[model samples]
Target: MTSALLEQSVVETPSSFRVLTGDRPTGRLHLGHYFGTLHNRIRLQRLGVEVMLIIADYQVLTDRDLAERLPEHVEDLVLDYLAAGFDPGRGTVFAHSAVPALNQLLLPFLSLVSTAELSRNPTVKDEIAHSRQAAVSGLMFTYPAHQAADILFCKANLVPVGQDQLPHLELTRTIARRFNDRYGKVFPEPAPMLSAAPLLLGTDGTKMSKSRGNAISLSATADETARLIKGAKTDVERHITYEPQRRPEVSSLVLLASLCQDRDPHEVAEEIGSGGAAALKRTVTSAVNEFLAPIRARRTELARDRRYLRQVLRVGNARANEIADSTLAEVRRAMRTVY
Candidate 1:
C-alpha cells in the first residue's frame, strides 16, 4: 500500500484495521525493537486498531533447538511489551503455539507458495547463513508460509515490520492474492507500516541484538545502561557530527541520543561540538537512562505479578483462537472442505 493510503486508513478507519505484530521469545527486546516497531504498535492500538501480538515460541525452534528456559523468555517478552505501554486490554497478545487453528492455516498457505520462492526470501537466506545449519530444518525452510498463517489467520490487514522484513510480508500478500484467485477471497493483503526511525545500530558498530551482547535491553538497570553506552562505538574525531553515511559509528551514537532526547540528530551533535565521543557517550547514557527509567520501573513492578501476566496471555489466547477459528472456517468453506 502507498504511504498516503496507509495514513488515510490510520486516521479515517483505524477501527477497521487489524495489526499483526510480535517478537520472538529467543531473547529480550531492545532499543531496536522499541523504535523499530513497538512504538508504532502502541500508537495504533491506542488509536483503536486491533493489534494481535504473537510471542512466536515456535519460530524460536526454526533456528535453535529451543530457547533456554523458554517460558521465562516468553514472559520477559510480554513484560517488555507491557512496560512499553502495549495494552493487552485493548489488543490481543498470545503465544503462537496456543492457537492451533492459526498453525493449521500454514498447510493451505504453504501450497500457495513454492520452495524456490521461500529459498529466495532474503530474510530466510540471512537466517540460514547465520544458523550454521548443515541441512535446513523443514520449519526453517517454510517459515515464510508459517508467518503468512500468523498474519492471515487473523485476517490482519496491517503488519508493522522493519524494511528488511518486507519480503516476508510480500510473500504473505502473494499467498493472500493467490488464495483469493484459486480458492476464494479468504484473506486481506496486509500492508507494511514501516518504522520511520532509521535502524538503530548496536554498541559495537553492528546490528543491535541481544545475542550479540551489543544491545541495551528494556529491562536493563541504570548502571547497566550506563556501562553499555560507555562501550558504544565512536570515532576519534573531536568534533561531533551526524553525517550517517560518512561517520556511521559516531553518527549512530548521536542518533541514539537524539532518539532518546526526541531532538534532531544534527542538533544533538551541535550541542556536543568538540566534546567528542566521550561527551557523546555520557549524553547518550543520561538520555537513555532518563527515558527508560519509568519503563524499567513499570517492568519491575509488573514482573512481581506472574499471575497477572499469565491471565493476560490466557485472555489473549482465547480471543486469538476465536478469530483464528472463524478465519479457518471461512477458509474451509471457500475451499469446499466444510464437509
Candidate 2:
C-alpha cells in the first residue's frame, strides 16, 4: 500500500476543519499583499472556515531585534489587516505574544523533534543564509516546531501558504506525525492551501519587500504613490511593450497598473503604445491611488479606534487560548502528564 493509505490507518482524524494563516507584524501591507493573500482571506472567510490570523510578532525576532518599534509596528500591522478586509467578526486575528498557551506548546513540541531535521529545513537554511547572522539563535533554529505549535494549538487543518513556504509546512506536518506517533494523535496534519499568486516583484524588479524599499505600502498617500511611480524605472526604448523577459522594467509598471486596475497588462500596453514611459507611469500611479483610496480612508477611520483593535485582539486571544488550552489538555492526557 502507498504511504498515504498506510499512514491513514494509524492516525485518527478530527471532525472540525479550520485554517491558520498570518504575517509578521514588522510593517504594513502592500499590493503584493492584495494579490497574494488579503483577497484570498476574504473569500476563505466567506466559505465558513474557522480562520485565525496570527500576528506573528514573536516570530519577527527570529531575524531582527524589534524591541523598540514593535508596538508601533504591531498597531500599524493591525490597521493594515483591518483595512485589507480581514473582519474580526468573521474570524480571530491575534498577536503571537498575546497567546501564551500557543507559545507554551513549543516547550513540549521541541522534545518531540530533532536538531538534525530542523537543520535540513530549506526555509530555515535559506533564512539563515539571508539574515547572514553567524550561528543562528536557538529560537530561530527551532522556528518550525514553534510554527507547529501555532497550528496544533488551534488544531488547524489548513494552512494557506505560498509555495516557498511549503517546506516549513512539511516540517509542521512532520512534527504533528511525530507527536501522534510518540504521544497520541492530538494534532492534525495541517495541509497547505497554496496561495493563488505565487510571486509578485517590486517596482525595482526584485521581490516586493519592506527592506528592499520597493514596496508601495497600503497606507501610502496619493502623493507618495505618484512620486514612487514617477521614480519607477521603465524601458529606454521609447515604446511600451508587453515582453517581461525582454523589457522587465516597463513590463513591471504595466503589471502593477494591471493588478491595481484589474485589467490585463498586455491590453494596457496596447492602449499606451508609442505613448511612452511618462504616460504609463501616470496611468499606473492614478490607478494605484484609486484602488487604495477606500482602503486608506477605512484605515484612517480605524486608526482613530485603537480601542476597537485592542478589543478585537483581546477577544481573538481568548478564543485562541480556549482552543489551545483544550488541545494542550488533550495532549497532556495522551502523554500521561496529568495524574
Candidate 3:
C-alpha cells in the first residue's frame, strides 16, 4: 500500500486533527521505531495533520543517572527525524526542556491525579521493571503525570501509539476529563492513533530494545547492519516460513523483511523458503541494508550541517513555546489563576 493509503487506513480523523508524538532522547532510533511509529508520523504529516514531534529530554531523567550525555542524544534524535522524512516546516519538532510551560502545567496536573491512580499505571510499572531500578524515584513514579502534561500542554487531540502505550493514553484521557470536570474544559481528551504496522522484534527474537543490544539502530552503518542480521538467531527449520508461535526467531526475520519490502510476511517467507536459513539471512540482510541506505546517506549529509540542525531545534522550540503559552493561558483562566 502507498504511504497515504497506509496512513488513511490507520488514522481516522478530521483534516484539522492535531497530533502529538515523541521519543525520549536516550539513544538513536532503530528499525523497530521506524516501522512502529516513525513511518506513521511522517505519513500523518504528509496528510496535512498538525503534528508536533517532541524530544522528551526530561522524561529520560526518570531512569538515566546522568544528564551529561543528553545533548548528544538529542542532536542525534533530530538527525534521525530529518533523515526519516519528518519536515520541521510541516510539523513542529521541539525539545521538552525548552518549553517551560509544560513543566508549569505539570504541577497542577499532579493534583488532578491521585497517588493510588499513579501507582496503578501499568506502563509505569513495566518501565520501572525494564529499567531494573531498585526503587522507583518520585520523578519516575510520576512519569505518567509528566506524559499527561505533555499531551495536554499542546491540547493535542490525537497521540499516535502502539498497543503497549494504550494505558498511557488512557491516563492522559483520565487526567483531561478530571481537570475539565474539576476546573473547566481546558484540554482535549487525546485519543490513541494506533498503528496498523506489526511490531518488529529485536534480532535476538525478543522485544526490540537499545539497552538489550538486540535493536538495529537506524544510524548503524551498512556493514554493521549486515553483520547484525547475519548474527541474528533463526530457527533450525530447513524451510523458511512465518510461524510466530512455533518459530518466533524465523518469524521475526520474515516480519523484518516484510516491513522493509512492504509486503506480507508470508510472501517474504515463501520467497526465501527455498534457500533455508542461510538464504533467509542473506535476503534479510540485503533488504534491510537497501532500505536504510538512503536514510543513512541523508543522515550523514545532515550531520555535517550542525548549524542547520541547531536552527531547526531553535525554530521548533519557539513555535512550541508560542502554542504552549496560549494553551497555558487558557488553562490558567479556567482555574481562576489568570493573575
Candidate 4:
C-alpha cells in the first residue's frame, strides 16, 4: 500500500502535500510505536514529504490533572524521533504550548463538529472510560476537535495514523469540509496514510503500552530489553509456527525477531523451529539489541546536549507558528472576521 502511495504522482510531488502526525508526551514510546509509526515517518521524510510533528503537551492534561515532568517528556519524544532516523533538517517537531496560533485554531474548529459526534468517537469514549479521574474534563470530551486543530492548523492534507486514530482523522476531514462549505476553502480534507508495517504485539502478547508496564521503550538499555524479552509470555509450543491466531505469544517474539532482522515472520519462525520459547527469546534479544545499538548510541549522544534539543524545539515551534499564523489569517478572511 505504501509503495503504491509513494509511487503516486501526488506523493512524488512532495511540495504539494504536507503530513501532520504527533504523540502525546505522556510516556516513552515503545516497540509498538516503532513498527506502527516512527519507521513510517522516517520513510516518508526520506521521500521528500514535508512533515510536522506535535508534541501534544496540552492534550496530556485532558485525562490527567497534571503533566508531571512535562519538559523532560517533551524532550524525550524529540529524542526518540531523532534516534529513529527522523531528519530534523527536513521535518518539524513542535510543542503544543509553544505554538499559540495552533491552539487558537482550536476554537473555530470546535464549532464545526457536533457534540453527538464527539461523544460517539470510539477513541474518545475509550479514553474517557479509562481515565484515572472519576470526573472528566471538557477538554477530554472535545479531544477530536483539538486533534482537528492540530492537523488543520498547518493546512496539512495528509496524516500518518494507525487504524485506531482513523476516527479522529475522519472527524478532522468532516470539520475541514464543513468549514470550507460554511465559510471558504481554508483547509484540505486530510487523508490517512496508514502504516504498511504490521501491528506489533507487546512482549506479553497483549496490546503494548507504557502505562501497562508491558512496553519495551526505545530508550531501554540492552540489558533492560533482554530482561523484558526474557519475561515475555509464551505457551508450550516447541515447534514454533508463525500462526498468529494460534500462537500469538510465541509468534510475537518471533515477529519481534523477524522485524529486528528485517526478514519474514514465517521465515524466521521456520528457522527457529523446535527452539521453543527460550531459544525464540534469545533470537529476539540478539536481534533487538543489535538493531537498536546504533539508535541507542545516537540517543546517548543527542541526550547529552540539552541545549541542542532546546534549539530543535525552538526551530520547530517557530515553523509551526509561521504556518499556523498564515492559516489563521486565511480562516479569518474566510469568516470575514478581520476588522
What TM-score against the true fold does each predicted structure earn? 0.98, 0.91, 0.95, 0.97
10 residues in a row with least lDDT, candidate 1: 60-69
User: How many pairs collide in each candidate, listed in order?
Assistant: 0, 0, 0, 0
TM-score of candidate 3 to 2 decimals: 0.95
The residue pairs that clash in candidate 4, if any, are none
lDDT of 2 by residue, 1-339 (tens): 333542242233322457888888878888888788887776667656668888888888887644448877888877898897888898998889988778878987888778898888888888888874556787789889988888889888877788889888988888889989998788889877766573567877788888789989999999998988888777679889878889887887888788888888899999988989999988899889999999999999999989888888889889988887888789889889898
Error of 2 at 7 (Å): 24
Output the lDDT of residue 208, model 4. 88
What TM-score does structure 1 among the candidates reach?
A: 0.98
The alpha-carbon lDDT assigned to residue 273 of candidate 4 equals 88
Off by over 4 Å in 2: 1-16, 132-135
Predicted model with the maximum TM-score: 1
**How well does model 4 score by local distance difference test?**
0.88
lDDT of 2: 0.82
Candidate closer to the true structure by lDDT (higher is better), 2 or 4: 4
Q: Residue by residue across 200-299, what tens digits does model 3's lDDT show? A: 7788888899878999999999889888988888876799999988998999988888888888999999888779988988888888999999999999
Query: Which prediction has the highest lDDT against the true structure?
Result: 1
Candidates sorted by lDDT, best first? 1, 4, 3, 2
lDDT against the true structure, each candidate: 0.90, 0.82, 0.87, 0.88
